[model samples]
Target: MSEHRQLPAAPPLPDPPPRPKKRQPTQDEITKARLKFLKEMSKHYITNEENIVAKEMFRLHKYNWPQILVVTAGCEGESDFVTFSSDEVLRVDREFNYQCVLARDRVGRIISIPLDFDIKCRVVSHDKASEKQFIANIIESHSLPVTVKFAVPDNHIFDLGESAHRADSFGCMALLKVYDETYLISNPLIDGVLDPHIIIIPLYLEMLISTVVGAEAMSVKEWEEYTEEVKKDAAKLDFSSVKGRKAMAIYPDIPDEAQDTDIYSYIRPDSYVILREKETGRIPKERINYCEIYKCDKDENVYEEITPSVPPRAPQKKPCSSKSAGPPIPKRDKSSTSTKLPPARSDVSDLTVAELGEKLKLLKLDKYVKKFEKEGIDGSILVEMDQLILKKEFHFKEFEAIKLTKFVQSGHIPS
Candidate 1:
């Protein structure tokens, strides 16, 4: 019995044959998995009304060629109905369904179609027919009991150019507002369609508008911040003024004669601030070289080495009067002015939120104390605050922004 022993424990059972290594998935398999997940998610989010509409539309036009009437507006505010075949609409819907899945996944919530997509239809009423009539016709023709309304909430229309520029990079999609919920639909036609539009129906005159079109593909908090920013921008009188405006320069050196002309200042990659005329499209060479040029930094420290071609002129001294002036005043040398920036204070950048609030109070900007504290802005963020951020993000007035900017740039926080 003792001789039977262990027999070397049966050679460890050959390690269970390595379990076949669980085969790594290929890229194609991974893509298919992702698409399957997106498809399931999109199906889960699609409303019953949308499904009914799709089914009825397809059924009604099964024998006859289907045509979708899309209400569109041109740049001149002129409106018309653009017709699309059933095949085209279905193709666009397929693409839009894919986009909705991606947007929902990225945003972690159901959102309207992103503004990156072309406009499909509008919720506004046309001269020929109102949204109510349109929905009434569809309901009567299909004999379906679906209700909708056109009184869209939050009458805020986003700036098309800005919204498109800020919207996340994604494929094209359309918009549809059924009853109170707005969804992304698909349409491929670019012409005759407004850049950003929504479709709605009128039953109770109450509707939910899609506010996610212009969103920057951020978190919920970020989206709220962005919407507030858009509202503030829309409310401001200078919103249109800032559009299409940019800092640009045609020449390295700007002449004195061009000083009176409207000019824009730009920060160079090397930290030098260069001045250029506002209209830099085409300018005469004579206007550009009319005077000596110089550059400056963010601290307004002027550097004269920008134009080496121009010779330095000697400063002219006025002749002294014969009569003795009561104690001759000392002349200040402009060349001797300090080019160094103010020293940074460690305490200013290390201040807590409470201390930052106190500093704001000292600066007579206590009104923003609540906002700062709510946003958890401490000394580190305070040090980085600028006029644009204060105005755009915090909704500060022009004077308030200027004052805050000065306070931050001074680097001297009061105790």
Candidate 2:
């Protein structure tokens, strides 16, 4: 038995070479991939006579072929496919899942091209800290470098150093200005927790374009031009409809005679306005019986009121019933006739500090009345203060501040 000199243990295998880091695809490579995908897709779906038209469109829009690809990537053709007539050169459909642009040749043979793209988002932030945290969370959660834009509501004090001119209600419209996308992210916070997600962009523009242009099919150039025009129109302030029409104030305490006027119209008592005339100057002195109505604008300043053309009417009195003569009527003093009437239900701007405390008692918020008095927050100041001011300066809790702010903003305190 050759004492086999134990063969020296085979040299330990060297550790496998560290795998090379996968190189990220560049923009050019990504675009190429997308184009290749779209070309293969066209070849698979398009056939016979329609295939010729598809190839021509691809050739004609070679510089912007990506646009065509996005517009017709995931489409399935069927007789039941919903079609919308465009004035330009293409017909479109409303179904987001099956969204497509249809092109027709002289004989009216139809080719459907699907439009699909990654949905990007624009977030509205009230402050820089919140915006930073929001973006950080989105990046961490998705593990992708998602492109995000930030918008601050008109008059919002964003610490991010960017001035935003867009209103919160039009945030979606601002997002639409970016034409290269499909879906939108909305309601970032769910149940008081930040949870951002995507929502389909409504085919509202397509429908509007179809209605306005009334075309059977639109050329690519025409489609782009019309889409841009529609987007611009959607973003503007439209006051033409209500310009000369009579408008009603949202507040109930406004005198019935003064409530409806041809000056300003609001959608809600607290925040929204439907139509407003540009301020010219102070209300004319000739309008004797005028009440100043304050409105918050995008600039954070209040709008001056326009005097109602109608004169304020004297309060009507109820006639006493002869059947119910309860007590012997006492002679009334004549001098009291000149006394001023009590303030309207919504008018508390004339109340004293102590009177304001009494008003708070009605809302079960009297605990903070002392704080208000201590801060010299009188009726005039109190009416102008918002929740942020109350919470920051008066040290009120979130709910407490919100309740009080709403009470003041509504301009109506409970009896």
lDDT of 1 by residue, 183-293 (tens): 223223222121222221111111111101222234457534533543443333221211110111122333447632112111111111112121221111221111111
Instruction: Give me the candidate number with maximum TM-score.
Output: 1
Poorest 10 consecutive residues by lDDT, candidate 2:
157-166
What shift in Å separates residue 22 of candidate 2 from its native position after superposition?
99
lDDT of each: 0.31, 0.32
Per residue, candidate 2 scores C-alpha lDDT tens digits across 283-383 of: 22221010122222122122222223312222212111001112322333544322122232356676789888887888657668888788777777776
Which candidate comes out best when scored by lDDT? 2
Candidates' TM-scores?
Answer: 0.19, 0.18
**Model 1 Cα displacement at 346 (Å)?**
2.5
Off by over 4 Å in 1: 1-344, 411-415
